[model samples]
Target: MTKLLVTGAAGQLGRAVLNHLLETSKVSPGDIVAASRDTSKLADLAAKGVETRKADFTDEAGLAAAFAGIDRVLIISTDDLATPGNRLKQHKTAVAAATKAGVKHILYTSMPNPDKSLVSFAPDHLGTEEAIKATGIAYTILRNAWYDDNYLMSMPHNLETGTWYTAYGAGKVSNISRDDCARAAAAALANPPAGSTTLTLTGSESLNAEEIAALVSKASGKQLNVVHVTDEQLAGGLTSAGLPDFLVKMLVSADANIRAGNFDLVTSDFEKLTGSKPQPLSGYLANNKDALLSAH
Candidate 1:
């Protein structure tokens, strides 16, 4: 039996992927390994007979030992953007450790258009991709699009105010749900392609800010107006709201990326992988209406 390991298994996306692997893909628990910095956080998975390993990205030897005898490994990108280049360094360490442990196949969760994306962390992803390729190992790069769940961060407040401020002039985004992305990732890991491949998981349809606002309004029974502003104005507003400098820059860069039409991409990669279409934004909004109304 081929052993599969998922690093960062305690995170939201990692847990979702593991759930799909067990419940949806029907992979045997004995063949799966869930690795995280804190093994206590994965006690539930351990209870299910999935092997839990302490895989710390900062320790190369520890990662290598954790990856021993594993056929395929999924390296979920770390959320260490507080320091520039730190996340990429961690990814490089993971890739190197996986290679050192003689892992046959490697998979990664990346962002859409990392090479040219306006997101501040695009370079980190691009650098990590380059490092993975340099290892000459069979790899699967799942470039996930913007998650519809991301809207929950600010949409509730926007909905409460009846106004959504964005810098995306008319550009659209093919926002996929975290669940759908997890499903696709699980499918790919369970049955990887013959060789290295890069797939961009995306939603069924692309929608602009106005279209998104309309959907949220219809779903939550609220009137939401989209107000367009320049990137500088948006950054200023976020700063005035007391958001940390790093977070303000990331959010503004995302809006700028949308405005530049970089995020207006639609692909059937998710359907190809899972043999099913991803849930549309309308359905997501309708299902999460109560959460959308609860301003954080």
Candidate 2:
């Protein structure tokens, strides 16, 4: 039995991947290890007989110990991307540890079109990809596109205000559900192909900002208008709305990418991996209607 370990197992995506591996793939709990900074958060998984280990990205000794006796490992990208170079440092540490541990196969969660993306943190992911390549480990790089669930944050405000602020203009985004991304990751881990590979997991369809707003309007039965603005204007508005400076910059950069058609690519890689169709934006909105409607 291959000992599969998933880092950041306490996080949203990480938990989803582990659950899919167990419930969907029907893998034995004893064969999987859940590694997180706080193992207490993974008590439920521990109760299920899945091993839980504490591993801090900044602590090399702890990572080495946690990675021991693991045949395959998945390094979910850290969430602290706001501080420049902090995330890259964490990823490098993990990659080095995995290589040193002689792990047969390594997986990484990455953003789509990182090399050419305009998103502020794209460089960090691209650099991590380079580091993984340098290690010469059999690798699987999953370039996940934007998650439709992210809209829950901005959509609530847009719905309440009756105005959808965006800089995307007519540019479309192939936004995949985070759940689907996790499922694909689980599938890859369950049956990794020989040698290294790169896959871009994207939504089934490309929808522009206006079309997305239309979906929200249909779901909520409210009148919402897409108010196109310049990236500078959008950043200014978000900053005025009390958003952190780093987040404001990140959102503006993502909009700039959308406007430049950087996120417009729609691919079948997700279906090819999971053997199922990716959920459409409308369906996602409908499923989470109540939560979105009541989000403060």
Candidate 3:
């Protein structure tokens, strides 16, 4: 049986990957290992017959042991915003462990344009990607696009304020659904390409702030007003909306880059990887219309 180890299994992307892997494949759940900092959190995965393990990446021994008999390792980017350096260190440890265990492939979920991105979390991804490449293992890099739901979180706040303010003013983003990213990951894990593959996954089309405003207007029936604000205003807005200081700075800078058109490009790489184009944003909205409406 082929054994696949998935780190950060408790996170959204990790959970989505595991769910799709279990639901859509002939591969038995037992052949997959779902690991995280806390084993108890993954009880549902364990109950589904997935081999569950408690492998905190900070603990070198635990990480090394976790890769034993693993055929492929999917390192979902860690979510420690407080100290991303620690997470990158953890990724390095996991890569070493996978290498020692003779794992055939290493898959990573990384940000697009990691090297040049002004995204606050770019360095962690770029460093980890560099490490993975240096390992000489057969690898695949999934440069996931912006998640559409990121806008949904601020819906209530942005609507209440009567302004959908962001530094990504008129910056077109080919945003794809997180579920599509999950499906792409599953496809890669199921039938991984032989050498290193770097995929820039994006939506079917690019959309600017105006397009997004129009969609919001249609989706929620709100006389929602769109305001293209400065990076400073966006930073302040984010703070007012409950973002932490560090994140506010980071995101504001990213929005600046967005204005520069860094994240405006569209790509067919995801379809090439998954053998199908991603589901459209409209479909995502329609499927989750009830949830979106309930937010109001």
TM-score of each: 0.99, 0.98, 0.94
Candidate 2 lowest-lDDT run of ten = 287-296
CA-only RMSD, every prediction:
0.7, 0.8, 1.7
Could you tell me how far off, in angstroms, the CA of residue 166 lies in candidate 2 after the best superposition? 0.3
Please identify which of the two predictions, 2 or 3, would achieve the higher lDDT against the true structure: 2
True-structure lDDT of candidate 3: 0.81
Rank order by lDDT, top first?
1, 2, 3
CA lDDT, every prediction? 0.95, 0.92, 0.81
Clashes of each: 0, 0, 0
Instruction: List candidate 2 stretches off by more than 4 Å.
Output: none
Q: What is the C-alpha lDDT profile of model 3 across 91-194, one tens digit per residue?
A: 88888888887889999999789888878788888999999999999999999888876767766556556677777776887788888898888778877877
- 1-296 per-residue lDDT for model 2 (tens digits): 89999999999999999999999878899999999999999999999999999989998877988999999999999999679999999999999899878888999999988999999999989999999999988999999999998998888888888999999988989999999999999988988867998899999889898889999998877778999999989999999999999899899999999889999999998888888999998999989887668758
Which of the predicted structures, 1 or 2, would earn the higher lDDT when compared with the native? 1
> How accurate locally is residue 56 in candidate 2, as Cα lDDT from 0 to 100?
96
Candidate 1 to truth, TM: 0.99
1 or 3, greater by TM-score: 1
